[model samples]
Target: MTKPQIVWLRRDLRIEDQAALRAAAEAGPVIPVFVLDDETPGERRLGSASRWWLHGSLQELGDALNARGSRLILRRGSAAQVVSLLADEVGAGAIHTIRHYEPWWVKAEQDIAKRVDLVLHDGNYLLPPGCVVTGAGTPYRIFTPFYRAAMAHMPPPAPTSAPHFHAPARWPASDRLDDWKLRPTRPDWATGFVEVWTPGEAGATERLKDFLDVAAEYETTRNLPSQEGSSRLSPHLHWGEISPATVWHALDGRQGKGSESFRSELFWRDFAQNVITQFPDYPDRSFRPEFEKFRWRDPAKDENAKADLKAWRQGRTGYPIVDAGMRQLWRTGWMHNRVRMIAASFLIKHLLIDWRSGERWFWDTLVDADYGNNATNWQWVSGSGVDAALFTRIMAPLTQSAKFDAAEYIREWVPELADLTDEDIHDPPNRPRGYPDQLIGHREARERALSGYRAMKAS
Candidate 1:
């Protein structure tokens, strides 16, 4: 009777550079498992679009495991109970997994550790959260210092290779991917997603290769939504299909501004995790306490507020750039980072809605709707988090669109204005035929936002 070890998979979906999976394989027969435990994350559960991606990603992982003479066990239930029961039933010698930072995941880890030989490894981040800190022994609240401290560490650990062996003489019971109903079928909002993405390890590596080919232009191209300047690796990174270390090692010694810019973007992901690790309640609360006093319109309580939020979500805010960004998110399950900031600013400052409202919407919509990054970025935009942008700094959507040369982006998402010239794309002469009027004039909204900021400061 062989005692098989369990390799529990989470966001770290890929087999390559997988430390825990390899460790489990080295020890004994490995039972690779992915438990969809909705009970664990609770309020921070994966959104609809994310689930859709998960469905395809799991299919790929299963195929990859099969090719390697192993199998990926799929289970749905409370991970603590399900994993523990499986271990006991199989008489497993040990369970290996990567560490995760989500608050609920941390709780599950504690509960599972008490019941099993849970061996934890760190492979989710370029540098595991809290590893880079100030000399005073505290997490760096500012990204620049954190970036400097992290860079001083130089190249990350060499990526571990995927294990080349079979796992378990007989596979355990697994759930069927299709039966889970992870993807929406009735409305099929994700129909566009297939055209834009391939959700697995192979897709991740291919995206990296594409980005590196033009890595030198990344700095300039990343800002222009029209160009394929951005890496578009957020979803893959969020799902752990590709490890940050693998991304880092790929760009190692690559001399170019684009590679350097892209590397900093990766660091920001790690920084968000660091912030969340230091402040567990970060998703719901602000890093700066005074932000609690800041007046935020409750869309749930007021019908008028609700209408504004609906318009923002549907991309009918009369602001061409904001509408374009919102529509892009609905169609593709992703948005350009520059437009994300502009749209976020419009909701927080222009609409006077609470950042949490926008955060929740993004949580439900983005394929890469990460709890840590979403919280950090929303707060950063709203001036509520550590090293946040000033609340007074309201982003003018029209100006942003013009500066980023988003005419092509607007035309792609907002077809109503596709016929307009470059000058008219960001702002039409008198509200184009089919387009809605601006929610509020840009100058008026800016003044209103400043008033709200002043009142918050005065209070």
Candidate 2:
């Protein structure tokens, strides 16, 4: 007899090219289920933005499944409890899902496996975890070497088509998705965001097509926040509405300067996952131990510093570039990679705040907020991460903005500054009509930042 199988959905939302679902279907009748228990992270439920994206992506996945003569079975509560209950109810002999690397998930999966035959797949990554390791079986410590090694190991996995599936004998009852209340209604600020984002697997493929068709100029235009030079696939990738494998497969014939740059960015994603694999604490704590003693500023006590964070978050910072990035994040729940670096540097260095604080905000707000990327990127900017910039290097927002046409970006987000031409808007004017003065007097803060750096080194 063909034993029943449950293809449990987690981050991997798409039925197309889904290793878990394909594996289950090969066996016999398969049950496609998505459990909305954010407790996979053990008390760390999904972030607001992630939950919002999840609601939309799952709706699309369900619609796709319904078209394929199946429906996404929804469940809530603990992974082990829910999976075991469904397994018994359906007489399912096995459960399968794309493996995840977060510590909380690592633990939960182990517990779930105890009750049911869980078939795990390394489907989310391009080469899977620990595949591209160092000579001694250690993970690559840094990105450049990691990227080189990753490229050498595989060109790109062949993208798979949505598998033909078989339905379960009986459909399981599901919770009304509306009751999930993942979408906000009381304080609806996401309408603009929703209008901008095309969520789900199908949407992800369209985005990939758009990027490849026009990727030749990404090297030059990507930095300009005003131009849509990016793939904007981060949210989709985060939710597993699409996989890195799908992306690599899709880019097989692409050859251009921008293709390499784009691949390099994706390599960073693999690199970050490798970091999380070796060090589960990569999200909360610095990988390097020496800098653990580094003293972070207390925004509550530091009136000037508190003002700086407020300015950055509210898009009111006197620095046009910084304000523009912050405002972009507020309005779109996303920011350009270059602008993200500038804004992150300003918060951690210029403002002398903890990177963790910035990480928390991005976690809550960024629609593409992957735990691995958000933590790694924040650590990278703060120079507290394992493969981060040295603590001595500080980003000059003024020079960076000028270099990247920051004024152009500033005009888009900070409409108040739109009145001032780019040349006049790069720096704060002596007495601008509506704009605030340089929030902390950046020059003074630069010196203070150096002093704090010295203190940290001296400690």
Candidate 3:
């Protein structure tokens, strides 16, 4: 009898298109393990919304494995230590898992490899982070060149089917998923998440199918938050319930601006990973050193800044578009992509608060909050990333709301403005009965943001 192979699960939760699971199944009897190691990540541990999603994703994954006559071993502790002990107990041949780029996970992988025969497979992104390089063989930092080079290798490998394997001779003791307390209990904040999301492989497949119907119109409709223009697959993709390769293959042979535009967005996800690989602290630190000196209103010491931050978080910011985005994010663990930029910009520029504040808030609130994507996007909006827009290019929230036809979107999230006409919905002429006043006028906020930029330059 061959020794059992251990498949260590992480974000890549699905059985299908899972390189590690496939490799393990091919070798011999399989033992699937999911270690909820919060200690390793320390401050970067899974946020509240992510933890809630994990409960559902893990439950579905365990059921799927059980249906195949396999068991998912659950444990909590230091990942490196847990895996090593499990390897000893099961007499595992080798440990297989998809590569993760988060700084903590990268370090954890290195430590685990030192103790066991750990084999890392590349299946998370379209391509491995460092695969696409410039003419000089260095990783491309900017997106356009990277996109062009990556496109040259378009249409990623076809997704593989789920494999079958024998179960371990004697299964180890596993923890009950419910005992983990992953979901909220007292004052349950995630009531809306259940209605909006389905957290498993089946759910991911359903979402992909729905997106296909509108994929041809994606280019025109993607920016419009009012309609179901977006794929709503970010949470699924983030959890690895669906693989990018699967998504790519699904979109294959569909010719149109929508498909082309959607593919670029996928590549952008890859770009974000490439960025974090180069700068592990990208989430915490600005790429440009000058930004280190940029004077942001510190909520810690400034009472006004603190109040503004609270208003932004609670979605009470008077800007209908910004408030709608924030409220939507709070109600559902997600937000429209276009509005995400607007809300983030309002926090960083209009409120003159640190981008890190908004990033941290989203990290806790969003089910799809990914470290790489979150940091890259926040830095991009703040003009502090290697590839970023100018700080001077302040976005006018009212103008953007009207331009993108977000009246319906606003109405759905901010019910206070629901009765307003399309003409007045974007920027209510007066304070509505229940709605708060604009946090700050667009022109004043833009000027303030630009002034801060000038101050950073002079400093």
Best by lDDT: 3
Q: Compute the lDDT for candidate 3.
A: 0.93
Task: Return the TM-score for each candidate structure.
Answer: 0.98, 0.96, 0.99
Per-residue lDDT of candidate 1, residues 1-459 (tens digit): 568999889999999999999888888999988999888788877899899889989999999999988888999999988989999988889999999998888888899999999999998888898888799999999989999999987688898888876567777899998899999989899988999999999999999999888888989899998888988999999999999999988887788888888898998898999998999888799788887888877887988889999999999999999999999999989999999999999999999998989999999999899988999999999999997999988888989999999999999999989999999889998777879998889899889888878887889
lDDT of 3 at 167: 85
What's the CA error at residue 323 for candidate 3, in Å? 0.5
Runs of candidate 3 exceeding 4 Å displacement? none
Q: In model 1, which regions exceed 4 Å deviation?
A: none
Candidate 3 lands at a TM-score of 0.99
In angstroms, the error of model 1 at 351 is: 0.2
Of 1 and 3, the candidate ahead on TM-score is 3
Model 1 lowest lDDT segment of ten: 163-172
Order of quality (lDDT): 3, 1, 2
Residue 2 of candidate 3: its Cα lDDT?
Answer: 92
